[model samples]
Target: MTGGRLRPGTIFGIGLNYADTIREMGRETPTTPYLFPKLTSSVIGDGEAIVIDTEITSRVDWESELAVVIGETARDVPAAEALGIVRGYTVAQDVSARDLQEADGQWVRGKGLDTFCPLGPEVVPAADVPDPQQLAVRTWLNGERVQEGTTKDMVFTVAELIAYLSSFFTLRPGDVILTGTPSGCGDFRTPRMALKPGDVLVSEVEGIGRLTNPVVAKT
Candidate 1:
């Protein structure tokens, strides 16, 4: 199934879950998970355009992330049982408005903008992805690779994140966890290469499918 097939539910996002990414940004590893939320309104199916709102912010960036789809109701689950509730996985692009994100001092508006989360061409069932931590996540902009990393580099594994999240709330069906992105994001690049009009970005996660989105100016 594609993202368009999902039912309305909560979407939790993990931040600073990659040690190398944290180091790349000159931050320390979190003692606890840094969590964020991405609204369901932000999600769009594959092959959609990621509109860059230049009027609101000029520094639009792209992040390739692995999205976990919950299959069962889980409350205070342990890591050993966390993966049992997973329905599948999907590739997602976490588009961001860097300037607005920084100015607002929170990720709600910047990370939850409409069309900011491009998810799924299809969902690969959890059974198909035996080891989520071994998957590779890559981002390409304008036919050139910009970011490449393996889930093994993640500071927190998928099961660990699920267990951690379930400790605080019930994770029901259709809830998605956008596991944090890796390093090589534009935010840390020299000369600051950011998304502009007329750019196509492809977010790929191994074992799942890819999402190709063109960047366009806001209407």
Candidate 2:
């Protein structure tokens, strides 16, 4: 894909949409989707580097997610018709800084850091993915499987998210919605796992190819 295709106009992140994730955080399943906006500048393609500034945070975490790429302008769309506006699907890594996320009491900065949102490998047309909910989402740290889950567990389906989001704001072509991640994020592990320089993070969504990026310290 070209840089233009990789650079989306807006990036929307859904939080705690998986049952295991909700249980890990000890929070009730949300009735409505939890949303946050990520800076487009943070996005990178496969094989790119996920740079981390040691001074800013040492608790960086990884979230494997399936991203919905918008194909047309959407407004007040119904869930049944939401997929009509989807261009395709891609893999994404929601690299996060847990310290900042908690200290700041918000997710923007923690989730929007430069090189935090890694997407691509390639976009699989929406039609190609017969049921977004049937796919598997996974993550690997330096070749060892760190996270494993399925889209079938998402609290809100892709169609539901698109419909809900468009109801409040217009979703233009190239906009991306990171359809919340599954369980096994580093933060809630028995011993927390954080990204470190030299570590390779492999994020995958079934059907969409794997998006691999190396973690590096900011020089």
Score residue 137 of candidate 1 by CA lDDT: 90
Q: Report the CA-based lDDT of candidate 1 relative to the real structure.
A: 0.88
What do the candidate models score in CA lDDT, each in turn? 0.88, 0.92
Judging by TM-score against the true structure, name the best candidate: 2
Model 1 alpha-carbon miss at residue 132, Å:
0.4
Give the range of the ten consecutive residues with the poorest summed lDDT in model 1. 1-10
Clash pairs detected, candidate 2: none
lDDT of 1 by residue, 59-144 (tens): 88888999999999889999998999999998878888888889999899999998898888777899999899998999999999
* TM-score (all chains, Cα) for each model: 0.96, 0.98
- Give stretches of model 2 more than 4 Å off: none
Q: What RMSD, rounded to one decimal, does every model reach?
A: 1.3, 1.0
